[model samples]
Target chain A: MDVDTDVTSGGGTARPWPIVDINPEALAALESYKKRDPSKVVVRFKAVGNAPIMKQNFYKITASNRFQAVIQFLRKELGWKAGDPLVPHTPPRFASPQLVLNKPQFTYINLAFSPAPDDTVSNLFKSFCTDGHLIVNYSTTAAWG
Target chain B: MSQYGTTRGPPQAAKDRTTDYHTALFRRLSWEGTVPLEIRVDPNELPANSDRGLACYFVQAPRVSYLPLLMPEIRRFLMDVVFDEAASKSLKEEDWWFEIDDGTLLKWHWPIGLIYDNHTILTTIRPGPSLATTSTTPLRLILHLASPPTDKLLLAANAEACKQAFMGQLKEADFIRWGNTKRMTGLRKADQDGLWEGIKEHNFEEYWRVASKVTPTTTANRPQSPGPPPSSVSMHGRPPSADTSAPPERDGAYNVRSVPVRLYLPDGPVIQDLVPPLLEDGSPHTLAHFLNTHAPLLFPPQPPAPPPSRTNPNPRPPSHQELAYPLVQGILAPLDSEMAWLGACLAGADGWVNVCVGISRK
Candidate 1:
């Protein structure tokens, strides 16, 4: 269950809890929300309840400059290699666009904007979680990692 | 083998084969164009039939192979125009397959098969079609049978001699210079014909390995670029994540597991590279971690379990007709009333089949 909270893209606000399962439709809306304020990256968040979740936290990467970090994260933290498909992912969304500490179900996160937009589907990226909602890493602008 | 009549059409010469090959129910889909399929960026990641982006230039389908039988006119045209320009000066300039693409900048040494038993000249030119579209298109190529001629020399001991000759040719062969063609070629297997014959099939790496076999590796190494600092490489069970450099979360939870995979009945050498590659220290690549990233796409839904029912009907009585032996009767008589005893003797039908019997003196 998604709840949309209208938060301005500023440094003050903490990110919302992210949704694990992301739908293309939600990506469109989140993309629109992000476009609402171009200066700052727009992130989506929600709290989750007792749903069986594989233990892992997911993050949406931005900032092409920090692409090296993202690569290191995959290779070092996640451990990927060349010739591998990109990770599978479920960019998240909320039923209501409002702020709430508690969500009915557990959530995963998507960047609203994917760094790798190739149409090829792979088992590479997966939905994960973080303490906060709307996972946004301003560290890098998206480019070939 | 029969000699080809200079008239050139396959006509009666290939009739029997046409019927046999076409009769096959499932026509094996073959990439008829020229360029290799699955061009790999990293040659090391080859051997298995998987890739990241795409290395298959697929830039364009090369010049038509000019099948002598399929399109005799085109073959004649090209022969007069390209292979034998001096002979056909009267042919129309437009009829010649001129620079539909660009001209070969220069010739280079390329390793070829029996096709170039004679020295072959090649050039570097982008195939014409690629300039417009990158997508692969369907085309057909047929291998003509080299019929035997009556005038050829006959030697009873030519078998081994012929083999040696072929091997001798390979021993002296050079490189397979890329000519002016391109196309994506998926792994393909062949039929009774040797075009893709005992050579296995169109496995990109299989082709590479086969090539590696023919092209001996020497002590000579390619000039090294004191290349950029090497990135520490890792392995993965699945495709690697696109963004690897992201900062690690101070507090995050996840699980990774490894399961033994079995290729129970591989039809061919397709699974040669199924095993994920290992790193220097013998650890998997980073991509392995991301393998479990997607649930639905990667792992399909499991099948439903069978229904549960607990009941045992009486066993069918054994046919006790002509049991002349008491031992047979002793074995058969307890048929119905001895289930409990049989249960003790048996493993209870849970699919275990074994028993232990010991005789003791009282």
Candidate 2:
């Protein structure tokens, strides 16, 4: 008999793998995940300053998706590759030595803060969405202070 | 509270002074907090004849600082211990990254304390003669000087790259707090330089001088009158048609738009939500409210079940177990701590409250 053969192949004494039941309490805890809305959120993109505008501004993305997805989507639509440096519109006074050295693409929400890449779409939609859409502003240059 | 009134010139000023005193004390503690680290080199990166024991280096890293800041000293120490001049010359700061025991690549951009807390689970060991009773264990990290996992981790090429990233985070936090980056953008070039210099030099006074302007200290500096709610701030950085006359109040008392909070969840992506400082009814929101709102599964609204009762003797654990603890500046802050107060005093050098959720094994 091959040692690698199934346990049940030759011996009547072979026993089935032990089956352990999961805690019902732990199962009930998953109700929170079940309660969350799995619907897609509408993200509307608007160009600021010298940034190019997309033909179709509205997109429906999974609510659980990160804001980074929106950024990558915008980058794809705008034909800008990742790590490509854009001309910064930094004012003389605002420009520091480090700003010139490392320049990443700028994307803003509500013309306000740039959400981190890891921020969830649902959180942004819940907090900042207006008119049933989360408005995202993108710029190749530093659009606003 | 009455005793303070008796000793001071004016009650309001005295209160402000007391608050300031406390804020300074807390801020100093946060700045000076350090994490004990045991760093080891990747065996592949070391010479074949190198002694494993000699390769390990131990240091107390400041919580507020970044790994890249201490890279030079760590590299120098390693050179003196294991490598020859030729081998050490090949080692560069830009080519380094750190890994935990479980092969998790640490993000260099985050503060040292955050990285440690997020990765390490702290269990309180019972006090005994032979064993230490400290709750914390030394964070063990493996340093790689070869290929970096660029896909997972951002490149902190050099000190300059780290500085740029830090400035970027400051602007992000400023925008979140004020709905605009004016506080950061309006900073003079010297003050901007000072912020980075202060952290490098570990000068509390120097850092706060520049940082205080960027962060809102009291209600006085926050927006007093609630003009158009943040929802009205239009997409183009302009107010909507209805509230065109009065632009959002850029500065006022108790007017913090949102608290820049980064919640680090174990086995999940970081959650950065737009957390308003005050509720609609002008009440301060607490850490408990914030966590309950964002992470209901981990921090359920229901209170923990009572201990074993007399009749029951042994009660089943709660259905929704509170599985994690929120740690800020290496301490479990009271859940009732006000968001505004926490934002002002306990934020990291990047101007964000980095709350690391340490998951319990039990």
Interface RMSD of each: 30.1, 10.3
Instruction: Tell me the alpha-carbon RMSD of every candidate.
Output: 31.4, 11.4
lDDT of 1 by residue, B1-362 (tens): 33322211222331222212211111111112233211112233222332323322222222111111112444343343333344334333222111102221111111111011111101101112211122232221121112212111111112232222222222211110010001001112221122222222333333333232222111111111232111212222222441133322111000011111111010100000112212234332222222222111221233444454355244343432221110010121221211111111211111011111001101
- Cα lDDT listed for each candidate: 0.21, 0.67
List DockQ for all candidates.
0.02, 0.11
Off by over 4 Å in 2: A1-38, A46-53, A80-104, A110-114, A123-145, B1-11, B14-19, B48-51, B121-136, B219-253, B302-324, B359-362
Top candidate by DockQ: 2
lDDT of 2 by residue, B141-252 (tens): 8998877877567544567767766787788788677666788889898999899898788788898889878876642233223444333233224334533543433332
lDDT of 1: 0.21
Tens-digit lDDT string for candidate 1 (A30-83):
233223212222233222332112123354444222222333443332222222
What's the TM-score of every candidate structure?
0.16, 0.71
- The CA lDDT at B139 in model 1 is 20
Candidate 2 chain B lowest-lDDT run of ten: B124-133
Residue range with the least summed lDDT across 10 consecutive positions in model 1 chain B: B263-272
